[model samples]
Target: MKDTSMPELRAMCFADLNNAVKIIQAHDEDDGEAAEADYRDAGFDNQYVLEVDGNIVGVTGYRDVPGTDQCHWLSWTYLQQSSQGQGLGKGMLLELIEKLRSENARKIFVKVSDYEDPELGKIYQQALQVYQGVGFKEEVVSNDFYDEGENQIILGLYLRDDEDQLEEDPAVSEEKPIIRFDGLFEIAETDGAYTFSWIVKETKKLFGKRNFSVGDLQVGLESVKNEGGRKVFLTFPSNLPLIHSPLQTAGFKYVGQLQNYYEHGVHEYHFTHDLNDL
Candidate 1:
């Protein structure tokens, strides 16, 4: 096992972006905009680092796609080979899940390559054990998803509401039940505070993908003349990057910026369109 006892957990920033770049480069061959895009798309608030004696030895990040009703997606997690066997990956995964749960996330997803190579195969098997141990269930597969011609296995885990925990744990009363939104916000009140809170909660719950944050509102819920307006919330895949132009074509427009939006301390490009404008 690695010397995990000396590792520190902290949020990432632009200054530390180069560290993430190195991690990506070491693990994958991405360069230039591809690497920078990964950092920007990762959101400052959604990325994290595991440091040992002041050097980043591990990285993990979450993302939220804009149109997918702010579904949380797991971007990626990586640890240096020197730190591989010390249970740091499990610890990091737990930290990410717990943080998302507190932020009101309902599901988490990750993609791991399943290859035939003995060495790479062991890595995938270990990753599978880590995710499954944490409650992830196999959900889907993308044929030939990796450069090595490996298939990608997608896994999913559901987040039980706090009230569900109370009932199942037998440690508290069931009267004070926790509430979760079931796609009802479209017709709900549109106070700035509520919208802001919803944005935060939604973003938190839907980390690990690019569409995790709302970039530009194609149509404010208010602008949707009918249920057609609500489809924007469902466009998120819960585990992939966000596509901006579709929402733009739908009617959403640019708004402003949200600073330090996720736990990763990243800024978000906010957008809004008035119902009246439609």
Candidate 2:
């Protein structure tokens, strides 16, 4: 079961370019023209956004890798501070991977920046964990992949074999059945019946026992509820049937399926769509 009110994925528009530039500048201050050029090159098919309630919370784009078996690079991805926890990043990455895989890309590469400060580097390292968790392997290290003094580590992963990395990665929160209705419905401790009942339905659909409990739908809901787009994600006890039709009827697209997300056998399905299209 998923929160019907959550926002979905949508194409990044030309109007969104200026703000997208600011988002990129926040990450890398240098080479604004190059970034803009990359966005322009992508055109309509290149970039996508994760929005909720009419705001762009996350962004990602793809580019072709010439003279290599791999066709494109998942060049950029970002989520606002408010949407940090609750698996939004993971969901976005999975969406991007699905598009790349559909093109029959043998592999996808992401080279993340590494800093000099151990503490700051740790933050990048944590981000690296997310990429690694998504099937991208740390392949090489360069003294300055972005800045003159900074370092960059090249990560690579085979699309077919590495897809499971997402499922195998450790769960972000310990809260059980982190559910949300931020996209389509309001979910709080006070109104738990709708979400709880659906969880039971999904569990029965999966043919698995209801061993897991719903902990925080608001937190989970916030992850997918973007301002301009809509995305749906459902975390269930792995053995259960994961039929999230309530999400589908609400116009969500099944983007990717993650398996073995936890040692205890929890799995998740990530879905996305646009609010206007819905």
Candidate 3:
């Protein structure tokens, strides 16, 4: 490469979309196209790119966690394969952290999957190490989150001093079957259609496993179908066996499960309702 200008971090622009996605695709071919669509729909507000001499080499950003006080989930952060081993990633991320601190963001979290390639080995380990080195603590781990044997690890970093922070102790933590359906929410909308998700929580036995009925599911689906939504999705831990009959009766179809998602031997079950079929 010729004498390029110094690397600089700046807000991503519409023109930088193609280059940024290319950087992401170079790292993981499967994720590039969907990620690009996400940016177009979500708009490029806090998203940024690392540029050198007018060329984009890296891209990273964060998405706000709804209902939380300035909580955020880190977005697709990737650099060109040729740029690996350099301290550029560290510098870029630190600047982003400082930027979030300046914006008074409370906390940030990132979810990474442990996928090992047959030849390349663990693909996401470097990124995980980088996050840990920057003060992000382990929040949770879901075995087989992506697929069979591929686990997901979530890490969080406090951006501001707060009193309500967590002091989690795994040993003392008792499982609670407190199930709550926070209502129907749209997760992805594209191609003139929307895909929404519902997550079932563990309902305590005292409250009765029949806390919800087919009518509730039908009501939520009716509300979304009338609003131009195309598909409604739902997921729950397979260990919660009581939820099966009720959901099946509500016209929801069982899709599949991610083994060991909630804990060892337990899995996450997926159910979906398609409005077009109705």
The per-model lDDT (C-alpha) reads: 0.54, 0.54, 0.71
Best by lDDT: 3
lDDT of candidate 3 vs native?
0.71
Q: In terms of TM-score, which candidate is strongest?
A: 3
Better structure of 1 and 3 per TM-score: 3
Regions of candidate 2 where Cα sits further than 4 Å from its true position: 1-7, 31-34, 41-44, 117-123, 144-149, 161-278
Per residue, candidate 1 scores C-alpha lDDT tens digits across 164-265 of 223122322212111222333441211221122222223344443333223233323543434433222222211122334544664555443222122122
- TM agreement with the true structure for every prediction: 0.52, 0.50, 0.63
Residue 84's lDDT within candidate 2 is 79
Looking at candidate 1, what is the lDDT of residue 141? 55
**Model 1 alpha-carbon miss at residue 257, Å:** 34
Q: What digit string (tens of lDDT, one per residue) describes model 3 on residues 115-205?
A: 8999999999999999998888776664444544666677778786754343431222333353545566555313223333445466556
Q: Which ten residues in a row have the lowest lDDT in candidate 3?
A: 188-197
Alpha-carbon RMSD to native, per candidate: 14.7, 21.0, 9.7
**Clashes per model (N, Cα, C within 3 A):** 31, 26, 1
lDDT at 92 for candidate 1?
A: 80
